[model samples]
Target: MSPPRVLIVDDNLMNLELVSFLLQAADIDVSAASNADAALRAIAEVAPDLILMDIQLPDIDGLTLTRQIKADPRTRATPVVALTAYAMKGDEARMLEAGCDGYIAKPIDVTSFASRVKAYLARRAASSSS
Candidate 1:
């Protein structure tokens, strides 16, 4: 089977690079976008299996975009994970409410980041198969 494709949507250049580098090192396909518009375009072009979204986007917020994705029949089944610095109380719940399938806090632990992403993909595959 082919490697899973992931789209990381974040306004920060460094964050995008770090996540992409880490995932790519694990032999995953990584695509990135700096803002919501680019992210939407990337989504259409990449047809990513998963999306890692940053809440504090320059354009539309990630949660709103997630809502849009969930509302769309074509993209609704693809898992969307919130990857943000918002670790406050109820933040994860709020993200989940907005349609995120998972949540990962920001300033990610580099050592375990790849494994965590792979776990999400594995879980998604398992769930879809069953």
Candidate 2:
């Protein structure tokens, strides 16, 4: 079987590179976009198995993008995990409300990030197989 594909959407180059590197090390295929528009296009072309999206983007809000992706029948079933620096109260709840399947905070721990992502992906795979 082919490695799972992950779409990462972040405007910050450093964050994007860090997460992309970590995920890639885990043996997953990654496609990145620096903005929401490009992200949407990448999603359409790649049809990734999962998406790790930043809540703050240059053009559209991450929550808005998540909602749009979830609303579309073509991408609705794809899993999305929200990645944000927002540590404010209720931020997790807000991300959940936006339709993300999971959430990860920014300033990610490179060591554990891949494991966390793997856990989610494994869970998703098991659920889908069931």
Candidate 3:
């Protein structure tokens, strides 16, 4: 089977590199975008299986971008996992409300990031198959 494609969107180059490296190490095909505009463009081109989106972007916020992506029929079903530094009360719920499939706080645990991503991909695959 082909490796799942993942789009990692973050304003921080370091964060983008880190997430891309981790996902690549797990044998996933990763595309990195430094801003919302690039992210949207990449999504249109690559049609990634999943998106690791950072909340704070230079142009548009991740929540708004998530809503936009989900609102479009073509990309609506693609799972989006919010990657944020904000781990305060209700943040996760807010992200979910914005249409994120899952939430991962920043200062990511590289050891378990791949596993968490895989878990979501597995569920997505199962659901699609069914």
Candidate 4:
């Protein structure tokens, strides 16, 4: 099987590049969008196995984007994990409520980021099968 394709959406150039580097090193297919408009476009162009979304974006926030992605029939089944530095009370629940499949707090644990991404991909595969 081909490696799972993932989309990483964030406004920070450094964060975006770092995440891309991490995923690519793990042999995962990775794509990125720096803002909501670009992200929506990318989603329409090719459906990703999972999305790593930064909650605080320059345009629409990640939560709103997650809801929009979930609402679209073509992309509704795609899993989204909010990748954010906003580690606050109730953040995870809020992201879930916004239609995120999972949450990964940032600054991401560099040592475990790849493993976490792998875990989410595994979950997506399992869930899609059954």
CA lDDT of each prediction against the hidden true structure: 0.94, 0.91, 0.93, 0.92
TM-score of each: 0.97, 0.96, 0.97, 0.96
lDDT of 3 at 37: 86
Give one digit per residue, the lDDT tens place, for model 4 in 1-130. 8888999999999998999999999999998999999999988886889999999999889999999999999999999999977779988889999999888988888899999999999999999899
lDDT of 1 by residue, 1-130 (tens): 8999999999999999999999999999999998889988999999998999999998899999999989999999999999989989999899999999988998899999999999999988998799
Q: Tell how far residue 123 is off in model 1, in angstroms.
A: 1.3
Q: In terms of TM-score, how similar is model 2 to the real structure?
A: 0.96
Candidate 4 lDDT score relative to the true structure: 0.92
Candidate 4, superposed: residue stretches over 4 Å from native: none
- Candidate 2: C-alpha lDDT: 0.91
lDDT (10s digit) by residue, model 2, range 1-130 = 9998999999999998999899988999999998988998999999998999999999999999999999999999889999988968899888889899988888898779999998888887998799
Clashing pairs in 3: none
Residue 21 lDDT, candidate 3, scale 0-100: 88
Q: Where does candidate 1 have its weakest 10-residue lDDT segment? A: 119-128
Write model 3 residue lDDT over 1-130, tens digit each, in one string.
9999999989898898888888889999999898878999999999999999999998989999999999999999999999999989999899999999989998999999999999988988998899
Residue 66 in model 2: lDDT = 98
Best by lDDT: 1
Question: Candidate 1: misplaced stretches above 4 Å?
Answer: none
